[model samples]
Target: MKKSQLAVQLYTLRDYLKTAGAVDRAFARIREIGYEAVQISGVAAPLAAVKKAADDNGLVICATHAATPDLLGNRAKVADELAMLGCKHTAFSCVSDFQIIDRGAVLEFAGEMEKAAQELNQHGLTFSYHNHNMEFGKIDGEYILDLIYANAPHMLAEIDTYWVQYGGCDPAEWIEKYAGRQILFHLKDFRPLFFTATTAPVGTGNLKWQEIIPAAEKAGAQWFIVEQDSCAKNPFDSLKDSYDYLTKNFVR
Candidate 1:
């Protein structure tokens, strides 16, 4: 993967991006940290302001966590917003009302995703699903994640490495399993924090980056985004640490 492919998931620094000016400041810091791209999520600023900040920082809007309401309720609006931001890819993290209780539920959500994806495609945008640990559960003897992808052919996979490990699966194996169907990959390390597991800066935890990076690259992942949902110190510090590690090692 090239250094240009490495990005910061803005959700990691959600607390610092509450307004237009904050986004500008945070993005400047992000660019200074050596990230050339970012996945937009959890920011409160308007799309126009976001675009301006990104442009000023020389940061590429690689992907976004599309608002579920707009994605399911109004695809045209989501597409237009992404177009304004100059982003071609968006991923649905989750919906508040959507629940994956069984096989039927999974299929139902997949159908919705399929419809939304088709609509987005018409507007020159690609849609993907971002997974959490809950998706690792089984439904009708199949992993919910596998079932979702098996059914929603139009929806790509945006696998989160830390969550995959949190769900008790091998991150590299899953990336390899979904080869050629992924354009965005989340790179966060998982480790035991006292009594429970938590996310860490890339290469700072126990995750096998050497294997994960190669698998992700081979799987057609174009963006390797670092996201630490929770951090021990300033989120920007965590972002810099991850950027330093990836650029020095993986980004070639």
Candidate 2:
């Protein structure tokens, strides 16, 4: 939280950034709200267009979320793509067809991701796993997330604090447990008593950022990417509010 910069995960702006032009506007607005960086995910614009827009607004492309298919089908292109954005951190968001709750299934899937991680590493990119609550299901006395990470220790962990809390675990604990393996941390606050587990900006929900922030810093997290999966107000407003909360409470 005492870092020099904070970033917004573009997934929070997914619905708003539907087209090339819209993506451009989103970057400009993010800059206006004092966000110096962004994690690209669920963005549908052309890679060149996205890079140009980020450059135009002086917004750093900090990290990204990629689908499994893209990783399998386009490894080199993925490398080239991140290079285009001047981003070295990328992650596989989730598995599409694999059984996330089963240890055997997850280990096998982690094997595939391990291969991708190694290949991407050769290209100077770090490939990581981003978890959701579903990964918290226990298999043989161990969480699926832990099992998969244990089997594939080389892949980085992009821990989502909100999902970890949703899954009944302390985000700070996992951040501590994973220590040197965490390269990116997703900051999403969970508002209590909301149907479908509504998400709020960081510090607006029940999460313990007082503890979460120090834990992340102590564990040496590189970036805290703020993401709200659902916003009660305009998405940009939600982003600005999150930005204000982080800058006011954490750091500029």
Candidate 3:
């Protein structure tokens, strides 16, 4: 797929959307910036209102990242909302805080995800998990993410490239290893700082975009959503720079 065929992860714009009327305005700005699609993190407004904003801006809501509590407690409601908004994929944004401390908690989480995936699958929505740096930590000499993938082979992964680097692994390697299991990618770049990785606009960071993009495409990534967790300036400027860079260098 062309690089212009990109989706913006609305989480990157969270700061701008903190107030009541900001989400609608943010969606409009996203469209004006030339994004064709969006992956919603959370919209405090009603589902209908969110859908209207997307429609007004000519942006497709292709995917969403919901908290595990929302998914488990209100699977039907969540699925219905996503379906109404024209989203085909729903992902658990992060593991519970407790799960982060208790490594064993992931097995139960995986079980829950398996059940949730089964439930959402019936509604024509594929379920997935979005990873952070914790999943890359070594447990018993293997990455915890590997264990999750092993336990829930059918579950999709929204691989965050920056987190992969932060976890001290290669995003392209994971892309090649998982292949078809990764349905989407969070395409953020990382800049090395001291002992850690920091978010940078795509192409400006150390990530091998040339290698990673092609690998993700080969692995069947349907959406490459741009995300910068903490922007150096306004979120829109960061997004515009990243979008321009990717389009100029990667998009065909």
Top candidate by lDDT: 1
- Tens-place lDDT per residue, model 2, 95-122, is 5545664767888887888888989999
How would you encode candidate 3's per-residue C-alpha lDDT over 182-248 as one tens digit per residue? 7778989998889666798898899998899999989999888999998888889889988998888
Clashing pairs in 1: none
User: Can you tell me which runs of candidate 3 are displaced by over 4 Å?
Assistant: 100-103
Best first by lDDT, ranked: 1, 2, 3
lDDT against the true structure, per candidate, is 0.91, 0.85, 0.82
Candidate 1, residues 45-149, lDDT tens digits: the string is 887898999999999999999888888798888988888999999999863324688777888888999999989988888999999998998977899899888
Global CA lDDT computed for model 2: 0.85
Clashes of each: 0, 0, 0
Please identify which of the two predictions, 1 or 3, would achieve the higher TM-score against the true structure: 1
- Alpha-carbon lDDT of model 1: 0.91
